[model samples]
Target: MPNIEYIITAEFHIDKGPSLVFQYPHQLPGLQNLYFLPELMLPDQIHKRNEDYTLFLLYRNLNTGEFQYLYNKNNCEPDPYFLYTIVLNLTNDEYKRGSQVKSLSILTNLSFFKNFKPVMMICLDLYFKSNDHHIIKQLYKSINEKSFIISRDSLNGMEINDISLIKKLLITSILDLPINDKIYYDENFRNKILGIGKSQIINPDLFIRKDLSFNSILNFNEMNIPIRIPMINLPDTIGDYLNPTDLNFKPNLINILNSKLSSSILNNELTIYGLQTPPIIILINAILTGKKILVMSYENSSGYIIDHILLILKIITGGGILSGLLTRYNIFPIIDVSKIELLEECDSFIAGTINPFFKNNDKLWDLLYDLDLNEFIISSNIETPGDNIIKSSIISEDARFLSNLQLSIFNYNDDLTTIQLIFRRHINEIIRILLSSKNFNNNLLPNNKDLILLLEGIGYYWSSDTTKLLEISCYQLISKKFQNLLYNEKLIYNLILPNLSNELNLMIDLHYHLQSLNNVSITTKINEREIWFNILKFLISGKSLEIFLLITYLIPPNSSTSLQSSIAHNGNITIFDKNKGIELLLINLFNFDDQIKSNIIMILQELEDNFLCGWCINLFLKNNLIYEIAFNELINT
Candidate 1:
């Protein structure tokens, strides 16, 4: 896909103030005379800094008319046509004519648009000097023609085993090597490591890639400049451009409140309803249940608080389920009093404001989070639309889970990343169990009686409002067939579940492939050593749990293996070997609840008693020692 959809420049004039200077290729459909164009380009204070950068989002509405606040009021599903905007400010007296500052921006649908920053910088510099439209035209042509170094088509096949093989090929090249994030900006890893003798040992054509590749350098002959893609990226990290690094990203939810706000206005009251429930729990519930959220702070800039809130949302959902759930399209990171009327036109959003006037009008938001007071102010006019009796169990479950997480977080010396993993896995587990429910039929729609049971059990009410929200939630990460059925008939069965069965089965297949590997002596080549390290890294990665869960879920009496014959007890089959079974179980033992843990102990005890399978018990003991060392290293780091 093309990275740059449109390029435009905005300038601040002493007489006319902020206005669009020019748009490349063709003018954007409805951007001309946009009410918020000034805000998009200049932000709060553009002249304060010598140079500045701002990020914003807009939808591709082709109206080309007056502002319509109610455009997407009915549907909250992610708009597939959302555009991310990056504005680069050049504040200097060198600019021509009536403006001292000019803002250059690229509007792209890519969440990884940060990669194109270098290109943007050069383009802006060149445009400033030459004032040639052809430079922008050449950039548009070159970016669109750029292709992935490796074929992405290898992952598009129907057979997951084939996809798994492709993943193995991709991951193994990066295997056993501590990711050199430096590679994202420097010369290629192969070129950096390979001397004359080493070059012969390693294949020159072999590709070593990362989860995100930010170092893809592009050359524009027309402009006579080369630029490397930038490093920073948006929250959604699962894309072709993802560049996995050695350093693990640990987002601390407790520290989500802006330091400026918290330091100045720290409050003892972090609860609601006279100290019964934590405000965070209420906030999570509000977001999950599809309520309009407005976070208000009178402190300096609203950007920090807004960014932190977005980070909190991203962390809670693990960047997987929330990818298409809510995005920049659904948020206004910075809001002022002037946009209040437009904000009110939308039925739902999560907005941040420095303006105190928003608090005076309670009807403006369904849930108002006051950073100054450290309180959650639930609007009196807003209420959850469902039977309280039926919702009790669901509410309890959510509260129990979140409260446990909150309590455990503060009480432990454990790694914050580990806690994040546990939180994410909990969410994935919920999706897995929901999709595996017997209440849903072959068509993937739930039966009425069982549907209500499913809904109530998972904390949803059976109503039109819930259904609409569900429809919006189900739009992303689902098959086209499911999406088609959902759009045609608004329903709950398609809600929030990401075809878990297929994903789990893929993990299982990948596990089977891993087991199929034969033991071999370590190779002497640097490339071979690098591959080994990458593999080990993958084993310890947070994402590795997907494959690990397949082992945990099919343990005890149900354990089975590909190399060995499937062991059956009471119609359930266990797959894989005893050593792998033990390794997998030990790796994710913490993720399992009490009941599952108890069953695993019983199964291990049975293996311990049998003289023939006694070696399995010894292997388990041996692996546990290695696991402890690795665990301690992970925590300490």
Candidate 2:
């Protein structure tokens, strides 16, 4: 032998046994007798009757661990012979000599062997495990292909006997095949090997056997699978997985709570005012329990305090209680309780102005009453003005508190003077906040009665100064909400119309917006003659003639002709004097045919005097003009 290498070993068991057969390559003349003749391998020696032999070659690439097969006979052959040749790679001689003979066995009963004849040929190389002569002889003797045609019931009994071993081989071989190979792409073979039938398989991991044990399922779970969960960093005060209190809140638990809260809010299970209440309660409880304490000096405390106070005000104004607090105190007592000590502990304290409205007001004071003056003094050390607090006061129901707060913050010489100035400065901010509030109504002026009272009081105090009061009131009337208030006849004539000026563009815009309101009677509030006079004044002012002409055309036809004639004559005298008269008159004549007819004769006379008659005739004739009878009469005149 040429340096005998590692032997391929395989075992096959069939119905009849104890007789071995072997095949050798043609080139190995010394082993010629070991090769079975074609007639002996075939059923009933059919090759003796001149039937062709179908040679099925199973080729394995030892270097790459791949297998493929091809048949020698062509498709035209009526009864082809089937011969299977399996190739196995050789190992190094040194290892082959030292290694023990290892065998891989495939067990199948005779019926299974016959039913799976093609599979047997395909898996031959994989079934063979060792090249040891004794092992090869033993495997060869164990497989008796001639006795493989057992009856159906006997085959069923044999299938049960060998199912475990057969299943292992089938699964291993199927899994080992290259994924993109044609053999691996055969769906029927794949399903059959995996024991899938009838219904579709859902979990591929459970393909081997449906009755897999819990441990096996767990093993599958441990295998790599694609699943993703997005991670977020939470504040340390929220706690960790082990201890789920605020001191050690788990991120997952907080995420779950947030998800639930968001779902409730989106589904409208909670009102807008109730949106932040739960988080506020959680924060307050965390502070009270000493799980988390927010420590800040008065300089930086406004953001935290302002947000909580706004929530508290909204809850109280909306007729809801701050659930866990004592009934004797209002919602914000906790601020004084916790903040005073924190403020005192800082290195230096800067005493800025806290809102004066909050200091002695009955509602807020009743909440702060339990606190000592010493604590108030300490907490007030670094108080400063915050715009958020002022904005919040816009919607708050407590007018007295808001007034007091404004007076304290601005340090005005008198309450009336301070409020008048504040109103002038923050009017836009106040109106914007009021319009954005949930309860705002377009038909009402100053929808909140509290805001109405505040403005009314300011107006009353400043009644003597009509100029300043009128300016302050103008801001309110121009706002959309206040414009809606003018739907009331008395308010339109008495309050709003008095404030509007006769400026042309402002009046135009107001007229345009007012036209959309079917409920308001515009003619009752506006003097038509005066508006027309102002519009005519605008036309003669020569500021915006196009707008003037547009407005003139919109007038009732009986009223517009005189206005158009006046405009055209004015343009003739002044614009013609400036030598641009013909162009201007022609523009008007083309744009407003009905409105400018009365002025055409005078305009044409101006054109004749300006030496533009020939130019106008040539321009019209070049464009194939057809002169109307009235236009011809104007020209003739």
Score every model by TM-score: 0.55, 0.14
After the best TM-score superposition of candidate 2, give how far the Cα of residue 373 lies from its true spot, in angstroms. Answer: 24
lDDT of 1: 0.43
The CA lDDT of each predicted structure is 0.43, 0.25
Kindly give the stretch of ten consecutive residues in candidate 1 with the minimal lDDT sum.
263-272
lDDT of 1 by residue, 1-637 (tens): 4567677777676667777767776777565445566565565554444555555556544444222222342442233332333344454465554336666777665554545656766776777677777877877776766642222223332221122322222222221112344333434442322211222222222234432232444557544333333222223432221232212233325543212222121111111222344455445444444457887767533344444455555554543433433433256666677887777676557787767888878788877777666666766566433222211123222443454455435543333433444444344433333333222334454332322211112222122345434432332222232233333332122123222223222112222222212212253112322222223333332233333333232221121122123322222112123224345444433433544444334444444443223332343455467654543444354
Best by lDDT: 1
What is candidate 2's local distance difference test score?
A: 0.25
Could you say which candidate leads in TM-score? 1
**What residue runs in model 2 are displaced by over 4 Å at the alpha carbon?**
1-297, 300-362, 365-496, 502-637
